[model samples]
Target: MINNHMLKRKLDWDYRQRCIYMTTVTVEKRRPLLGQLTGGLGNPTVELSDVGIMVAQCWQEIPTHVPGVSLLEWQVMPDHFHGIIFVQAPQEKPLGAIVGAFKAHSTSLYRAGARQEAHLWSPGYQDTILLHRGQLANMRAYIQDNPRRLAVKRAHPELFRIIRNISACGHIFAAIGNHFLLDAPVKRQVQISRSVPPDALAAAEADLLAAALHGAVLVSPCISPGEKQIARAALQAALPLIVILENGFPPLYKPPKSYFDACAAGRLLMLAPWPHHTDRRSLTREQCLALNRFATQIAQEDHTP
Candidate 1:
């Protein structure tokens, strides 16, 4: 039988595979020690403090000390660091070990400079393994735009607040960046974009709305006209919805008149994985398809029976 402790621990997957890795380390208590965010909305940058510069140096030196690990890209934020490390070949140590070493070295330097005995980083960093080329590209964009996203969030704290670990309806969701993950007990359904004939859009929209009205959470990027129609219907019916956005929420995101009622009723959740792009535009085919896949995955995680 799996013990509770074992069940709670994340599986130690083999880290020798050639793949892209994304990781984030936050400062304990989320103090803005590493850098300061500067600039206006859509043009924010991080000005590294003395400690921040040291942190960056430690991260840059990782490749020299760790075999088979290449630093692809990295961004230093106010209280955290986001980096993409690629494992080019099998290494003697795991990816976690490499990260641990970097964290220890950076923390040591920070403590010595600050002349304090407190922890620098919060325990246990967050990591994601990119399994596909498309994911790699998307993650690369996300990391590169971290500074700009932080700026947008600061400009509009009301919409971009990182509501961490929210529990709703027996599910725990990590609402961070612009995306949300429904950890378990997910109820999922798929509505393909541009798949419905123009004449059938009304009926398809009604069907989707009916699913949500019946307690099936509607999940989508809501990009297609038909999908948007369904989203509007869900709002009108006061049904719960999980919307995936192509861009980050605008500063002080006030829902449009159409969505205001639903949002007020606590029946809407908007999610996005990308930074806010000031030049808002239509979604690319790849982005539309990727978000649809993510919706399906969320639905599949629903184990409620």
Candidate 2:
């Protein structure tokens, strides 16, 4: 006999264990105080490597302080920080207490510096638990690229364009430098030396599709961390055997309805391996075509122009 309020609280509190989480903690003024420490533009100037090390150290400190909690990679941006904490609900202290302790420790250390200014962080924080595997990768990218997101917002000004458009085009798209993936083995293979214009993109895509079509199984890792560039690239190329590794839940093979929607709507088609089907190499080109046709039919039936 759980009351409504207790049931709701239980539902919320149940997000522990391998439940990947994303937390964005901003500064008091969004002052880019984190940048002062990691952006290479601040007074005491903190290098990105140094920030990474500091975050790692903080992560290590958690198990000792709160027990049953493990730290994951995080990014310190100009104005905020994004981190993931793995909480083992069985043995860990309350999540709120753990977060507060971590924040207090970091804020104390940050403010103790000789150049200490206003409060190190804004009030409270934001958190989302990863119930699905794809969300894990999405959260990783969200944390690492907070600064890039800010830049895009400031430079573009029109947030609407960013929200509506999903394709990659122009020089800015080509000039991106990615090292988000830990231990990049195939990065050199994917780097494009020249700027490709929109008009010629389709021709290039056809060529890419032809090249990748022969493979029985194609594994396409999302851009290091969770950057969507590689996924977007694969979508643009219309590669048939493509698979996207989303969060840690194993690769979801069947592309989400939203992903297929983009393809049917004349945008790029970013297909991945369907989930629960382990033997990907078993999928033949004919099966791929059949799946694609089915996806098209579904999209046409449900999606509006």
Q: Residues 1-305, candidate 1, lDDT per residue (tens digit)?
A: 21122112235578766767888777877789998988876568899999899999999999899777899889888888989999998877777788889999998988888799868887767677788768877777777877766665456454445454555343444343223324334454547557778768876776776666566777777777777777777777777777766776543344444443444345666666665555427778898777777777667764554
What's model 2's TM-score? 0.43
lDDT of 2 by residue, 1-305 (tens): 21122112224464435455666666566664444443321222334444334544664687787656676657676556677877655544445566667777777766666356536666666666667867777767655554544443344333212121222211011101111111222111122223556445456444444544543122232332221343455555544322322221221121243343333332232332233222224545565454444333322232122
> Which parts of model 1 are misplaced by more than 4 Å?
1-12, 162-305
Query: Could you tell me how far off, in angstroms, the CA of residue 206 lies in candidate 1 after the best superposition?
Result: 13
Strongest candidate by lDDT: 1
Best by TM-score: 1
**If scored against the real structure, what TM-score would every candidate get?**
0.58, 0.43
Candidate 1 accuracy as lDDT: 0.69
The whole-model lDDT of each prediction reads 0.69, 0.43
Cα RMSD for candidates in order: 12.3, 14.7
